[model samples]
Target chain A: MERWIISFCIIAIEVWGAVYFFDIFMERKRKGWLDKGRYMILYLATVLVALLDMYQDTMVIKVLVAVLELMAFCAVFYKAELKQCIFFSMLNYSLLFLTDIFSLLIENILNSKDELYALENPFWLVPMKMVRVFLLIVLRWIWKGKNSYGALSYKEWRKFGMVPVFTFVSMLVMYFCYSGEKKVQAAYLFLSAGLIAMNFLVMVLMQDILEKGELLRESALTDQKKESQLSHYRDMQALYERQGRKMHDYKNQIRTIQVLLKEGDTQAAAGLAERLTESIFVEMSAVNTNHAVVNAVLNQKFHVARGQGISMIFRVGDMSGMRLDGEETVILLSNLLDNAIHECVKVAGLGRKAVINIKLVEEGGKLIFSVKNPVAKKVQVADSIVLDSGGGMHGVGLMNVKAVVDKYGGDFAISCDQEKFQAVVML
Target chain B: MKIAICDDREDDRGALKALLEAYGQDFEIREYGSGESLCKDMDYIRECGIVFLDINMDGMDGLEVARQIKSECPKVHIVLVTAYVNYALDGYKVKASRFLLKDDLEQTLQECMDDILREILQEERVMEFGFVEGNVRLKVDDIIYIETNKHKNVFYTQEQTFNIYKKMDELEEDLKEMGFVRIHQSFLINMKYIERISSYVMVLTTGKEISVPKSRYSEVKRQYTLFKGVE
Candidate 1:
């Protein structure tokens, strides 16, 4: 009964350790203790795995069952792709096998006893279990905050999944071949330790590569967005030039109207004047903020907003005090307005004419820039940080804005309610 | 409403006056040929609700006059009128409420006037509440947010907090049309004072932070966004 209790305790710790290991790397599908059903299933699975470990003498069969149970638990509990769940399950089982081997090797070295005898003795088993749990905890601590697992694609997972599959197969083969031996050698223990270390290094390197890839992709997308915005600005400039030509024609038309008035053709003069005024008013109203870059970005975004059936209102005040240069202004304003436009476009429907309000004003020696737009969904913010809703470039755009704001030693803030989202930057 | 139109050219001033009259609103219109003359009449500058200044005036340009008037009476809305759009940056520097192209005056003046009138009306709105001390009149714009504490609803403004025996639902119903948003059950915030809303918390212009419940977050945000767009 005592031995059964110890085995259950060891299995409980091992199951919990695996859960902790995967939990660090992957996001939970549902959080909090309120998820009692999933938690109950997980607990029952762990107990079943513990009972199987006691009844089953074959190490390979026991590990396989435990791994399958873990994979099942992960599938139900984690918000990850199928490939990721499988890879994490396999990797976790391999690590558990390695720690078990390490603990057995240590016990053998301390007692100089046969491996079977070390396994059967309660004195050896309890300390070995403690050592195994300790190693697992240390390994978990190393990967505590790294959660780049979700970013890995299926292809990447397949490539990285090879390491653990190889390790698991090799460890099982080694255990089967060497378990029949009288005593475990110290050299074999060193080999298993080296294998464990290699696994740790590979995972750390994989996470680093994944993070760097994500950064590269985000920056590349930002560059592409900037290129598109600049082209949009050029198109707006062409439109402005066309308007300038029209203005010249209006001048001639004015001259004609004045000539008509001089000729006492009052009716014809008024008719021409009315036509000119109407045509000019029908043209796109140019947003003229004396700052050339600000005017370009705002006008381009305004045109884009209008194209999407959304209205953009600008309430700009003294921009001379704004510390941003041409490039910074374009990045900051375009990203902000683009984010606003993106959100507004989502909710622009019948009876709801989405509107974006862009405000740039200098107050009390600080340049305050803000954008407000109607939100169709709830925005999650935790501890003042805006959490990305995922699946869109909105988060990346805001990050770029935040980067520019930070570069200028400015304050960037985001606030949202059920209907609206607002981003504010103070420089 | 008292309207001041300052332009160096008499023709532009007369044209603006004609447009103002055509709008059919009761406007006490005053015209100045130059920025200097407009600046000289401090009493008129202080009393007027809106000032239309021409940016290309000969002596003391519109931007300079706007800066002076803004310094003297910050409440007065200055609309900068310029033939060239390039002077818009300078207009922003003087904190002009609106910038109108001299060429597009006929098209934009009515819209500009409507916006200014709405703002002026919002600013002038006042409500009297029975406080613990007595009935006190409060400018609707001055109340930043209202918080329900126990049986009393506390009104927070920039200067002071007024504790009154009032229901939040009743106040929300009354102030619904006046730019006040019910962000939370306990908090009815004035949209004018909202600096930003982040992480389910509303931060005011005066740096007071109020927590917004997750369920009502999206609705509150939408209302705030609409309020800002209208403003």
Candidate 2:
């Protein structure tokens, strides 16, 4: 009866350790924890299975129960896509499975040496049980806070040394189980511990590399954005210089007109004025926002809107005090206005002429930017990018605006209904 | 009122003198044929209520003369007179009160002097703030931005920086009308000073780069756009 009680108590302790470690591994809180009743039910069931396995003395039942427990744990605790949850659960269970194998191997080694004498001795189980508890506690501590298991992509999770570590631990477990000599058992246990430690080190290294990769990707994206903005600025500069030359020519033409007037050639002066105005028609299209870059972008967008037969109402309030990188300003305005124009164009077929209203204003020390356009069809937010029925990567322009807005620590709000879509960015 | 007209060409100065005289305004008008002579007569330049400076001058340009006159007497209004309208933008950088094209000399000059006369009769738009040495008065137009460095609030202009002991919020209230924006915790930039902004960085007219916090970037950009847009 005492021996049965001792085994039952050990089963309870083992189940408790597994449940506690699972909570830490998944970064679940103890108080106000998710699905508390389910966890309790699972814990009771796991303990029952463990107790039954101990009585039946079957290794198959033990492994099967562990896998079932893992599935239940993942379902109740993990909030992620089914595939990602399963992947995370597999990682957690693999460690638990290896710990079980190590415990079983220690027991087998002792039993072989003393003809099942050590099995009867309660003291002989101390080292094996201690190792299990120590491994769990260390794992719980290492994965104490929220592990970013959900954030990682499938490729990242796979490439981050999970498969190799699992294989290495499995091979060590097999070797330890087979090597049952008295002296070799302790050595095998230490070797397995060393290998597990090395696996953890590799995990840390993989995480670091993953973070660095993400950083590099982000910087590269910014660089690409900067390049595009600069090209736009260059295009605008060329146009501006051309306009400047025309302005100079207009002055010289005025001088010619003055000379013609002095020579009593009023008809010739009138003809020159008409020709001069016609020649500078393109130059007259340029928006005067006081900032050259903004003026260029606005003019470009204006021409685009005009080409599409979309009525573009672009109003810019005092922006002289504002200075933004030519590239960034171009990217932000071009993308935003482009998106607005694209939406307006899509809905043009819906009987009404498309129109977009863009306002760049300041109030309360904040620059208020707002763009409004009628929606062509239903809008869907996919991958955090707002998309209309007129699909493709058309939403990329708005996404670029969002990226720039986010970088500048600005507020970007989008309000879309069946009829109208408005995006406001306040910096 | 004392008026100083500095032009490199004798004919241009004579034309300016004739125009100012035709306006029939009772004033003492001093003409400098070159920027060097205008800069040399510091006493007359200091005492003048308004200075009409020709931009293209030999032996020190009008911009340099204006800079020297500004440092000595910031209260004195400097009007940039040039043939090219394009040069008006450059004139604005130096805080020139008005840009008068030589072609419309009489009308532009009369308008500028009339505005100055009205301002003289009204309140001065100068903001006086306490600095390290003492209280210094600055024309609202001359200020580029006010920034916080450690504990000091540094006022940036086109030519110089003035360090003062003042809170950002307090200074903001006083300078908001003058088109100053607080871009970051440590930065209150004059919207006029912004030459370029991208990502988290803003380039001032002086070629100094200012880091903008991501959270306040849109705010800074919007404010700047509005300031530039309205005028």
TM agreement with the true structure for every prediction: 0.53, 0.46
Query: By DockQ thresholds, what CAPRI class is model 2?
Result: incorrect
lDDT (10s digit) by residue, model 2, range B1-231? 899999988899999988888888888999888888888899988888889999877789988888888888988888888754444445655767666657556434554566567655333468787888688888776787777889988887777889988888888887755677888777788776677677679988778998887557756765665454322
lDDT of 2 at B51: 94
Q: Which one wins on DockQ?
A: 1
lDDT of 2 at B160: 84
Q: Which ten residues in a row have the lowest lDDT in candidate 2 chain A?
A: A387-396
* Candidate 2 lDDT (Cα, 0 to 1): 0.66
Model 2 interface DockQ: 0.02
lDDT over C-alpha atoms for residue A155 of model 1: 66
